[model samples]
Target chain A: MAKGSLRINEISNAANVLLNVIFILLSFLCIYPILLVIGTSFAEETYLNVVGYKAFPKVISLDAYKYVLSNAKPITNAYIVTIITTLTGTVLSTLMIALYAYAIVQQGFKYRRFFTFFIFFTMLFNGGIVPWYIVCTQVLKIQNTLIALVWPYLINAWYVMVMKTFYNTTVPSAIIEAAKIDGASELKTFFRIVFPIAIPGLATIALFMTLRYWNDWYLPFMLTSDPKLSNIQMYLKRILNNLQELLNSSSAAMQAGSMLAVVPREGARMAICALAVGPIVLAYPFFQRFFVKGLTIGSVKG
Target chain B: MVKTVVKQLKDKAIEIKKKKSFFKDLHDNREYLLMIVPGVLQLILFNYLPLFGLILAFKTVDYSKGFFNMDWNGFKNFEFLFKNPDVFTVLRNTLGYNLIFIVTGAIVPVAVAVGLSLLKNKTGARAYQSFMFLPYFLSWIIVSYLVFGIFDYRLGIFNNIISGVFGREAVNWYQSPRYWPTILVLLHIWKTFGYNSIIYFAAIMGIDSELYEAASIDGAGVWKQVLVITIPSIKPVIVMLAILAVGKILNADFGMFYNVPMGSGALMPVTNVLDTFVYNALKINGDIAMATAAGFFQSVVGFVLVLVTNHIVNRIDSAQALF
Candidate 1:
């Protein structure tokens, strides 16, 4: 029996060691491609052709950076637009969603059941893109404007439900009662007391919002025709598509220009991805502790 | 008492009774009602309002006719869609890829999560979790570019390594249909496994530590404990997520397929799915109505699947039903 138990323990230990090694190797696989893009972006195009993408470049060059930066005006504009949209959109949406979530949590609200059903109903069905396009373009008249990107995605029902779940779970009844006894108005109670405690919950949603705004290319592609209003992702896509078109066009000078354009394409994509995700990634560690707490509180009940 | 005073008194009593009932209802269920409003409004504007536009699917659109003034085509648009020979191909590709994605996507993440949970050291586990999650943050476009770097026939790492070493011809991955399904599945797992694993990890963590202790006391090994305790504890969550995924098996990840394939016609046989098909058809024909019909079909099928799955779950275990 002792020998059998020892054998079982040995097998378990072996499996554990193997899993750790595999997991670490898998992690490297995920990170290396991203690093390759960065490395190639900084490497001379000639060197890249010679040595290919590597952890370290054969010959270091800033031609890609110089070309990208010289043509940086459009990218800069895109960054400004994306940042404004993400910040304003996240703040506005978060507030509106929290307000609505709070109202739904109040048992005394007159239309609670009706409203819940109304919200849940939308999850099941939606009118396709045509009506939405017509409504936004013809009725709202937001075509070729940044507002088109911001307005359509300003509120999401799923986020609201998640917020409501957090509120119901974490914000204790005693705290609200204490605030009420202290002569706090309903609005005051929400804005002052509830909002602070819900920051971690709000942060999770905000990270998602930032990601959505940063990654949004479809909206700008479909709605906006003007180049100036294009977000970074859209601009990058246009550049890539233009490169393909240029490759097919069979113009030597244009091909050279497209090759030159490829310089920024990888770095800029990495840069934009890095820039867009940098803050959230940086901020995530701070919220990591709270996230587990929030998830447990929010999900276990539901 | 005067007749006028008696009439005024009766009117005041009726008003008070009405107010009291309203107040009583409000007091009984105010919190539940408040919790639901924001979600309701968002749905109304973003979701329900778009739903009203489903009318466009039935119309033969003309720029001159305006949105509302377009001629009604009844089922003509849908008929056009069904008539196309490629429609069936696109549908089959979409469903086939998604079915593969669903099955593999469900399995791999759970495996990864279980593996991560078994790691003894906290720091190593955290580092692995974060690194694995890095791919999920990248946009599909960036991922496409990264894929090109690996599979770029002329200068790709694969070609450089294999052809250089073996003196063999380099495979043009973009042109090969047979290899794409595997490539796409691999990419999907790489990008998503970390994000999905978080849920399973949380579920595992929630399992009672005492259960493991009990198993250990019975001389059961780690693998046996996992089989007996951890799997059963988190079965509900796994089941819930699987059902949710089944609800949308008809909908493909459009961005991944569209961007990764990057308009390589040679690979369309493997890469083209329903969403991309609709996108391509609209691009070629500029037919808003037909595209909307496709969208409507997808939405309806997805909705019915969710309802049916929910019903099945309800029958088996009431607590697991999403609603």
Candidate 2:
């Protein structure tokens, strides 16, 4: 028996070592591409052309960063648009989802089934892309407007369902009952008691909405052709689609004649990407902890 | 005659009371009703309103004449969609890629989750998990840049490695359709497997520790423990997620198909799924009817798949079914 247990231990130890190596390699695969992009972003264009995209910079240069910042009009405009849209969309969507979710969960609320079904039906079927595009552009007439960015993602039914589940599990019923006994109104009870207790849930949904709004390029791509309304993602997409458009069309960048001649085309694109991806990567730890919790809550059998 | 009139009056009074209570229920929950109105309105505007516009699939739309003024045309757009040779390629690519994704997606995540669960060093496991999840946060546009950095013909790291490290001729990755299937699948797995693993990880975490303890006492090694306990314990979650993925088999991730390849015409033969096909038809070619027809086909088939899969799941395990 002692000999058999010793053999088991040896096998288990070997398995553990193997898993560690595999996981470490897997982790490297995940992060190496990101490092490559960052390294290329800082590399001198001439050296980059010669060396290709090294995991580390061959010769460090700030010309790409310099060009991007010096031609800051479009980038800044995109940042402002993205920031405003993300904030507005996150806040409004969270509140709307919370309110809608809270209402449906109320035991005494009439039309609860009707209201729940109204949103849930959307998950099962959609009008597809073309009709959605037509409705946004022609029917609502939100083309080239800020509303076009903020409105489409305003109430994701999946998020609403998640928020509803969060509320069901997180919020205690006794406090609401007591508040009702004291003659507090439904909205007042929710705003004061439920909302305070449900902060974590609200934060989770808000993070999701923030990410959704930040990463939205499809809306601008489909609904609006106007450059003035482009968010950061859409701006990046436009540059990605046609690199020459930004380099040549931005007259200011072109007027900086000597720099334009050395305009690290590949490096500049990577720099733009690095800049766009920087914040989210930095905040990923925070997002990951909450998102894991949110996903589990959402996945729970209701 | 008097008795009959009295019975009629009684029925009328009951009807009036029922009508009043219906309004009373509405009045009682007035605040709750008010709260959900905005969400309901949004649902109607974005979701349901577009359903009406689906008729455009069957119509010859003329914007100059306005939306409602379009003439009815039956089967023309769909015929055009089917008559095009590209439809078969798109359908095959979409279905084939999705089939590969569903299988690998389930297996890889489950393995990762199990591996993480088994690690004796808690901090190392956590760190590894975090690193894996990094790719999920990135927008596909950013990922495209990463792909470009690796695959860019002259200067990409892929060529650098092949020619410089391996002493082989560098291949133009974008221009080659044959290499794209593997490239795209690898990219899809890289971007998602980490995020997907989280769900399975959480499930594994929830499994009873006593099961492992008992199995170990029986002289079962790590592999046996996993096969006997871990896999069976998490089988429901694995099945549930797989079914959900199968339901979405017809709908490819648009961002992945569209942005990742950077619009390489050569790669389209392998990369052009239904979503991108519809997008190109609508945006690039300005063939609204063709795009709408394809979109309509996808939606109908997709809806049916969801319903059918949900039915199968319900039959096997109602708790796991997505109702």
Candidate 3:
């Protein structure tokens, strides 16, 4: 077993080829589901009603999209709500988290440990949804408002901690000291000097914030009472679950029987799925670079 | 190191106080302290305040009187969960699905990371990664529809494939409980393995290439090198991920259990866990007390499990212990 051999190299090369084939097959499997949804969404709803969705469509139609777009008001409204919330939420969450993270990392700050524990404690225990719902509705009076969509997610404990670790390790002390030597205010140093250098880390957190706000339906579903304020994901879930459209079939037998009776909804469901996933797919490559850099630096966020 | 730094920090503060005015040091850092105000305030309002609402778990809310006037009924609130008729089914599904996820969660990521690492072409690896990462970027709502698209019995791709291949009737996937556990596991793996693999892939990348070189020089075959080199190189990351996963074993992802099954009453046997059950109860009755009880039950059980797990991990290996 001591001699380095040509035969083993040949075998390894062959094995690499086999592995490549397996991964390509696996990659195709991953790509195919999303394609099926996209293809079916464009396919005539009747074709799926006859034979279901296909990996590749036999016929093409835009009826599902047309049906969805016909309800253009709600879709546009939800999209607007999602867009506003995503933009506002990511910016605010990233800023506040970076600020807090930077504050805690400074050795001169006396309460850093206490503040760290204060934020960290919330991660370990939560009051669950009922009370959270109560506070948001009863005390804060956020329900049925646009604010409800963005308010709850403004700061996540995990992201705050990640940014804290990022600042602690990456933003060197020498930079802050150099700025202080010039009589720069703490705020001045942070904004003018430190924040620029920390953009990569901030962008990483921003990517997470953007995705969460874009994809979140839970916050809206629980916090907001107004359908006008509902996000797109909730709208999709509503369509998927609202079996009441299956006629006056309140009975269990009829409900189950009538599930297939709601055939058009299947195509509509895929259309909505595609609609919801569309923006994320378009925007992901921009965030793709930050993902590897951020995750590698602070991989514990999960 | 954290303690040593804190100790030195206190010593410096004391010496600085003796040399200068106390207000000077406090004045120096007040801006930094001010920076933290919004974060602390938001956290207290959102995260910690709800912790105070955990008291509702012990109370029967009387909306006429508000939260302050709610009746303290002792453990009577917990009766909602422990006394529910579906208690066994809900517990079974939550624990069962979570266990399956834990096992798959450990194995699938490592497998993907190893497989991806073996690729020679960076472009192809990146493309494959993009495909895998695609599903993770999508929300559960979209994922549910994507899954339903394939399993829609009458019009689903799976039924058509089987029927076309086997000349058999399409199975009604939604109504049938027999296939869900497998389907759910497969979906769980599919949605997650891509993201999880990246963590292990990063760890694998960090392993010394020299070890692999040494192994190849010793005439190790690909399989042997992978066994002795790649897997062992990523062992710590694998163990860390597994330990963290075990901490969350009692808690199921609500979106997956709720949305992905389309919340079919027929499939609830296999799908309804504590989160969805509590959600349904709250949705129907608006009974804050009962809902809090369920929530509290999940949190308490999950908390205890985490503690026990961390303790065991601490005993075995202190560095990997979460605390």
Candidate 4:
């Protein structure tokens, strides 16, 4: 019986080893193609065409990077637009959500349920895209403006709900009462006391808001036609789509264009993706514990 | 008469004091209210205000005529959408793809998560989890590029290996509709399984270890313990996720379908869903009203489905209902 048990343990250990190997291989698979693009960008275009994308370059070259960086004006513009929109949108949205959440969670507020339902109902249903597009273009009149980028996604219902739950759970009732007794006005108390305490919750949601803004391509795709107002994702998408068209165009000039495009196509895309995710990844470790805590606190019951 | 006037004045004073107390209550809660104002205003402007634009579905848009001055078309736009053959095809594709996604996509992640959880080493498990999650961070555009690198007829690794080994002809993956459903599903699972597994893994983690200990004490093996304890503990999450997915079964991942196929017309039959179809139609016709009508139709149907699903969930188990 003891020998049989030992055999079973060995089988399990082997299975575990196999699983780990598979997982590690899968991880490499996930990261490989991305690394390929990065590798190909630095390789001579001629070499890449001859050898195909590889683990190591046949001939190392920075010609692509040079070509892409040479026409760096548009790429830099895209970066500026993306950064500004992300920062503005995240801050505005987080502040608004924090306030709305606090108000709805207040027991003394007479309209709390009404306001909560008003926000909650939006999550269940919405008017479709066409009407929304027309409203923004016609009524809001933000078609070509920078505000268009920041405004549409400013108030997220789910975030508000998450924030409200955070407030209801984390903020001690006694602390709030003490603030009230000290004759601290509601706005002052919130900014001074509640805001500090809820930083963990706020930071996680801020990261979410930042990611949403940075990753957003749909709004710019649909709402704005002006190249000047385009975000990085949308701009890159355009460049990519244009490349496909150029590849199919069969013009002599386009053939020349293709060589020039190949470098930027690889480097620019990787650069944009890296830039978009860089801040979030940097901030992630600091907020990792808080994010898990906030998600469980806000979501488990909901 | 003098005595009566004095009593009336006293009553008035008491009423004034109550009003003062009410205002004072508002004053006391001012800080909390201020904290919530920015979030509320942003939502109102961005989310709520755009909802009013739903009215434009009833009108024929003329750029010169302006939004309010546009010709009223009653139900004509919606009629046009329903009348189009493309709408039916799109609706069928959307529902079919999503159903496949929900069923298969749901199962694979749970299985993967359970398998991972069964692994006993702390270091290996954490590393595996992160590995699985890496794909979730990537954009669909990036994912499409990766797919291209693998499946490209000229330079794809698949063709390079197969032709070199077996002397087979290279396949053009994008033009093949027959292969897309499998490809799309596999890709979807690859991209999303890690994220979905996190939820399931979290749920599994929450299960009391004591239950597993008892099962082991009873001489139940690992598989038996997983079957008896782990699966049962995570059943509620699985059910909840299923119901939520059912609510939006009419929608497909537009980015995945549009980008991965890269507008290869040959693959449209299997790949085109409502959103993509509507996008194509809008591109061709520039008919805002028709697009809005279709969108409105989707929203309504989707809303009704969510309500029905939630109602059913409530009936079966009140705790599981989203509301």
Candidate 5:
């Protein structure tokens, strides 16, 4: 019996080793491509001209990054635009969501079911993209403005639902009753007592909001024509759009014109990619818990 | 209740307060009501306002008169979108790619998640997870660059590996439509499966460990336990994800189709999905009305699909159904 158990252990151990090997290979494939992008970005343009692109370069230089950063106007403008919108959007949206969520969770609040359904119903259906565009452009008149980036994602119904659930389950009823006994106003109780404890919840939603605003290129593509008004993602996309034109055009003149257009310079393009991707990766570790928890809670329940 | 309030109250005014009227309750919580106004207003403006604008689908949009003021065309916009020769191709492409995505989406993430769960090495699993999940955070524009690095004709590592090592001819990857369906699917899997796997991983973690321990004592092996205990435990999640995916089958990922192949004209035949089709309608025909009709069509189909699937899921498992 002892010998049989040892044999069983050996076979399982071998299986486990094989599984780990497969996972390692997969992780390497997933990560190596990004490294290739970074490597090519650091490779000198002359070396790029000499050997073309490789996973690892013989000569590494900062010229690609230097060229990308050389014109500070567009890059700086995009950064300022993205940062401002991300901050403003995340803050206002989280507050709006939290307060509304808090209102529904109040025990004596008579309209709880009505308000909950009001938000939850939006999650199931929506007027299509064209109507959304028309509403933003014709009615709101937010097209070609900074507000275009911030407004559409400002109140995701799902985020409000998540906050509502979080508050209902987590916030103790005794604490709110105590606050009321102390003569705390409803808003004062929320701000002083509930909001403080709900920071983790707020932070989780904020991370999602930040990611949404940061990663979005579609809104700017549709709504804005002004380059300065676009976020960094959209700005990079504009450059990419130009590169595609160059690559696809049959005319030699257009192709040559594009090579000089600062967009088709491969090293510079890769550098643009690196710049856009770098900060989010750096922040990923710190917010990893929030993402896992938020996504799990939001989807699994819904 | 009335007798207790009347007899126990120290102040007679407190008796009236304790016996609250509807208006009194409303009046007392007015500030809390005020706090939720912005959220309510936001939903009304962005969401409900768009529902009203869906009438644009029935109109010929005139920039001069704007959306609501445009001339009514009845169903002419839908007729235009559906009547075009390219309509069948675009429809096939959209539904075909979604079908493929649904299958792979169901399988790949669950397999990876299960694989990750089975690993006994904790530190190795964590490290591997970070690497796997990194791509999830990358914007598609950046992903486009990564794809560019792999497949660029002159400078791509793929060409280098093929031509230099194997002496194979370098194929202009973006120019060929035949290769694109495969390439696009692979790209989607790489970019998403890891992130999707996290959901599966969590589901696996939530499975009762005692089930596996019990299986082991019954002479079940590793694969047997996985088959008998693990897969069944996470089946609900897998089903849930698949059903949710079915609801959005009409909507193709715009970025994956548009940005990845670098919008090469040749790949349009393969990559022109519903979302991209709308964008192209704007670009090629400058026909906003037709685009609106297409958007309306996608929305109606998606909504119906969701309701049908939700009904089906509700019948099977009440708890797991998306309400």
Candidate 6:
């Protein structure tokens, strides 16, 4: 029996080693492509043409970065647009969702069921894309503007549902009752007592909204034709679609004649990609925990 | 008789209080009512109003006539949609790809989650998870750049390997339709498996360790333990995910379909799904009626699928049902 057990232990140990190797390879697969992007960004433009994108730079150069920075007007504008939208959109959406969710959860609020059902009904059905597009462009008249990006995504039904779940679990009814008994008004009770306690939940939702706003190209692609209003994602998309456009319009000075011979076409494109995703990639670890927490809680119930 | 009269009077007073409570409740929770006004208005503008706009599907919309007033064209829009042979191809690609995604999406994540659970090195597992989760943060636009870098005919990584290693002519991947289905599914998995795996991993974590210990002591091996205990424990999560996928079977991730292929015209036969189809019809072809009809079709079917899936799940496990 001892010998048989020893054999089994040996087999299990081998299996464990095998599992580790497999997972490490999988992890490498996940991360290697990003490394390729980063590598190609630093690569010399001439070398990039001769040798395709590699896991490391073929010949190290900062020409791409210099080129991108020298013509900083569009990139700067896009960055500003992205930042403004992310901050304002996240704050507004989180507050609106929290208020709406909080109102529905109040025990004494007579229209709680009606209000809850109103949002929940959206989760089951929508009038699809065409009608929604018409509503935005025609009726709301929000096309080709900053408001287009912010307004449409302000109240996702799923986010509201998740916020409702978060509020139900996090903010105990007894605390609200205690605040009410102490003569706190409904808004006061929420702002003073409940809001402090609901910060973690709100933070999770805020992070999600931030990511959504930061990463969205769809709203810009659909709503705006103007280059000035394009966010970072949309800007990157424009570059990806037409590298020749970027090469031709290197700078206003360069646009006077054909100076495409020296343009870092390949390197500049990857550099822009690297720049666009740099913030998210760096800040990922800090926010990833909250995302996991939100996912677990949100999925377990809903 | 006097007692009965008094009781009847008391009941009448209670009835009147109940009747008056609507206004009383309105008066009482007026603060909360004020709180939800902005959200409700936004919801009405964005969500509810669009339902009314589904009328555009049945109408021959004229820009000069305005949105609210249009000629009733009956089934003409839908007829235009169905008459196009391209519609069947798009429909097939949408359903086929989604069905494949549903299967692979369920299996791969669960497998990764289970594999992570089995590892003895907790730190290593966490590192693997973080690395995997990194891709989810990338927008489809950025991912398109990565895909382009890999698939660009002259300078792409794949072309380098193909021509350099095999001594063959470098193929233009952009022009190829046959390779797209595989490319798309793999890309979808690569982008999403990390996030999806985390959900399953959390579910696996929730399972009691004692059950595993008990099975081990019963001389069940790792594989047996997984088959007998771990999978069954997380069955509800697997089922719930599958049902949700089924609910959205008609819908494709529009960004993935649009961006990854880089809008290459040659790849349209394989890459075009319902969302992209509607988009092309509306934007490129300027066929508003046809687009509206397709969008309306998707909405009604998607809504029914949700209801049907929820009903099925409710019958099986009420706790796991989305509703």
What are the lDDT scores of the predictions, listed in order? Answer: 0.72, 0.87, 0.78, 0.72, 0.80, 0.87
lDDT of 6 by residue, A35-79 (tens): 888899999888888998976975888878777776778899999
The DockQ-based CAPRI class assigned to model 6 is medium
lDDT by residue (A3-100, candidate 4, tens digit) is 11221222287888887777777767756766665565566666666555544567876655555455556667878998999999999888888888
- Worst 10-residue lDDT window for candidate 2 chain A reads A1-10
- The residue-by-residue lDDT of candidate 5 on B165-214, one tens digit each, is 89999989988889888988888999988889888888777776667767
Model 4 per-residue lDDT tens digits across residues B46-141: 567767666767888677986568888899988888898777778888998899888976797788777767665656776677667666666676
Candidate 3 segments exceeding 4 Å error:
A1-11, A243-268, A300-302, B1-26, B214-222
DockQ of 2: 0.52
Runs off by more than 4 Å, candidate 6: A1-11, A250-261, B1-20
Q: 2 or 5, which is superior by TM-score? A: 2
lDDT by residue (tens digit), candidate 6, B220-293: 87788778987998888888788778878889999999999998999999999999999999888999999999
Highest TM-score model number: 2
lDDT of 4: 0.72
TM-score of candidate 3 versus the correct structure, residues matched by position:
0.88
| Candidates ranked by DockQ | 2, 6, 3, 5, 1, 4
Worst 10 residues of 1 chain B by lDDT: B31-40
**Model 4: docking quality category:** acceptable
Chain B TM-score against the true chain B, candidate 6 = 0.92
lDDT of 2 by residue, A1-302 (tens): 02112222234667778989999999999999999988888998888888988778859988888877768888889899999999999999999999999999888987888888999889888989999988887889998898898998899888888888988888889989999999999999999999999999999999988989888888888878889899999999989989986677567777663645577788888888888988898888777888878877776655
Provide the lowest-lDDT 10-residue window in model 5 chain A. A1-10
